[model samples]
Target: MTGQGSEGTFCLVLHSHLPWLAHHGAWPVGEEWLYQAWAHSYLPVVDLLRRFADEGREDVLTLGVTPVLAAQLDDPYCLRGLHDWLGNWQLRAHGAARGLPDLAAREHRASRWALEEFETRWRHGFSPLLRSLVDSRVVELLGGPAAHPFQPLLDERLRAFALRTGLDDTQRRIGTRPEGIWAPECAYAPGMEAGYAAAGVRRFVVDGPSLRGQTWAGRTVGDSDVVCFGRDLEVSYRVWSPKVGYPGDPAYRDFHTYDHPSGLKPSRVTGVHVDPRDKKPYDPDLAAAAVRRHAEDFVDVVVARLRSLRERHGRALVVAAYDTELYGHWWHEGPAWLEAVLRALPEAGVRVTTLRGAVEAGHVAGPVEIPPSSWGAGKDWHTWHGPQVSDIVHGNAEVQRELLELDLSGPVRDPVADQAVREALLSLSSDWAFMVTKDSAADYARYRAKVHADRFAELAALCRTGRGSTGRGHERAAELRRVDGPFGHLDARSL
Candidate 1:
């Protein structure tokens, strides 16, 4: 929608999340996902922001971290595991020296930097680094549901609990509470704004179609003061679209063409349909040049979009949001391009600000109703609730129902009940259904969903027995707690 005012602002939002993977499986999925995203995406992205902050940039972007993922980043087990993984990565790079010398050199250098960064700065855990960023106003952090659950498909009571708990978890870690959220999956249903307002969230994001493609400015939801910022897909997809995106450029590293010996990617994209073995060796100089060109092109696009929108509205705020992992994790050159774009935007006269800054600057286009929607395929709920995930959809519903019915009220809070809540939340994570529907690590996604579901049932049944946690039940709860722990401050009674 055309928002109010003549001044134009551009807001870049990145949703950073992974399901609770602390004690879950490793390799292929689980903890591996966490470490990869952390090293390749979070580490570099945050570093770039910190560097720019040194040069005095404020409100660089809005980054959202789901509470489940936040807990993993701070967990002792995860911290220790990441240290080991970096060491292992160094070994893997060394092992590649004989097989692919050039790639080995690059990998070794990167691995060394990663390990050093982890040891010196990240060893303390995520909160300190994130807290500093928040304190300095380097970036705006957006909080979300505790488990990154699909909010539109969630029970209202659970939804509110998750949001409040998630925001509280963020406050505990970063010191300042988030006023906005990168709504889980950018998913929403009618009246959800009321729940957000109830949880003290002043703003959230949704897909463009949710606002009927009027994405030029923020719009208030229903009668609530909570504002909804629709992602401008036209701007976001220039760098993220699967087919035509800048990441697919031939000069960039090919994500799929890996040198199996060392588990490192060494080839340039060459062509979308080219055989992996036929791709050319990746050249950093070439990729850097492409980054510069694409970054300039992006700036030009934003300028043109803002110029077009300015003709209709007094103020234009062009929003472009993407998953945080997309940068270094999936697209090797993404972080460089991002830095380039952020640096160029201001020089091009575009106000680079966060979604909050947009609201504060009066970007509201007035109240509008949002329907059931998501950033998922077709801009609807099918990814989490579609026919392909019918089993998972049904399983999650049953888990939520049982948890709601269970009596967790007691004078002394029971770890059993607390874990049951955690398990239930983990089981309901949208990642499982999404993976299953998309066929990306479907087995791992299913296994995790079932594991959490089973844990929830076991814990819930023990709580229902009305016997104080003891013997086998006590031992079982402890075991599960050790593995699935996240959101330590969560109160099951919040249900």
Candidate 2:
């Protein structure tokens, strides 16, 4: 155990991710999903971190930017689409000025601010913006497998390939390789730590129950020196949870119940059972108060939790992990609350650090064998493999089996074969299965999975027949590339 001061260490791990949504549909569930999250969550959070960096604060938190999400953010198609989306947001705010003047005014200001930030900081790509943060030492970035595959179900060879490729892509974009990863969904299986260590990943996260609720310090995986930090759900749930959390406050802007006139959320969460039509107009002042109260309450929770954990363990560490999109995107006042908490933790004598910082400071325990688990429902793998999503599971399994059998070596190697692997990996993303299980956007998820599967099958067939470079094969490859071309330098030989 490591010695600590009066206050214990607190690490905030935010997983920022989204499925590949570039050339897909736009309105209710497609590219719009990417744009909204970009405008609401990424921009504000980055701004907050930059402010802290300027104030000479290092290791504000640990941020996990999945390779697939990074690819979309750095894609030209998505960048142009996001730019137009911001413009439309401003127009919508202007259109609502008459009916909901107060809401419209606030939205207009927000839209303009988002537009300016996107144009200035994110114009080229997220690479420069994220690289700046890493270079400034404000946050330790976590990289994950390409396409965010649930590694437990993946073939061992393909898993290693995905991890290496994803890490290489991260290094290419961000100018540095990540030493830690936010395992997709915090899912883990025995012996996966050896693969992480081989890829130079020194640390990753798992759910609290994976450690049997003892998460005071990072645990070594199996006999490997790699560290696994468990999420402190007690502290994390205070900010956001299933039934009751700060986001459910009556004063906060309601995420659902959108106003049809201007496509803006103009109402507050009146009550648990309040009708959309009966909800009152959103009051910024009231929401601001809620953010303040929630932020202070969260700080107290962390301080108290750390102090309590210290009683049992001499030196303690508390890790609170959450989806970065929760702030500003789902819960409108989340970014403000996050900023408040980040600032208040230090003032209250809590040591705010990153997972890497804690590990380097020797705040880690001995090896422990972790069972198969994820931070999903029931703290198990059922969400991705349950009866509800059996089809997706079987389909992904077939794709992976076919992918491992493909021959991409020697003189017969085809470029189309490389694209086939890419498509297969995209199809294997856990998002499709997760969406189907959650019923959030089942149809879209199914459609995306089918599209990628069809593309992979078609390309693989062409390669198998030695016609991958022929006329029809070339045309099909071109079409697929035009639609999904994030990893341009992908080489099948790597696999």
Q: Residue-wise lDDT of candidate 1 within 1-495, one digit each (tens)?
A: 133222379999998988887777787887898998998998899889889788887899998888888898899999999999889988998998887888889989999999988888898898999888888887899998888999888889888888888999999888888999989889998999999998889999998889998998899999999999999989989888755899999999998888876788889999999999899999999999999999989988998899888887756789999999999999999999999998878777888888878888888887899989999999999999999999999999999899889887777778778888989988999999999999999998999899999989988888888543877777787788888888888888767
Runs with alpha carbons beyond 4 Å of true place in candidate 1: 1-7
Which 10 successive residues of model 1 have the least lDDT summed?
1-10
**Measured by C-alpha RMSD in angstroms, how accurate is candidate 2?**
2.0
lDDT of the candidates, in the order given:
0.88, 0.90
User: Model 2, residue 36: what's the lDDT?
Assistant: 95
> Local error of candidate 2 at 186, Å?
0.8
Q: In candidate 1, how many Å is residue 35 off?
A: 1.3
In model 1, the number of clashes is 7
The positional error of residue 462 in candidate 1, measured at the CA in angstroms, is 0.9
Evaluated at residue 136, the lDDT of candidate 2 is 94
Candidate 1: global Cα-lDDT? 0.88
Per TM-score, the best of the predicted structures is 2
Write down the worst ten-residue block by lDDT for model 2: 1-10
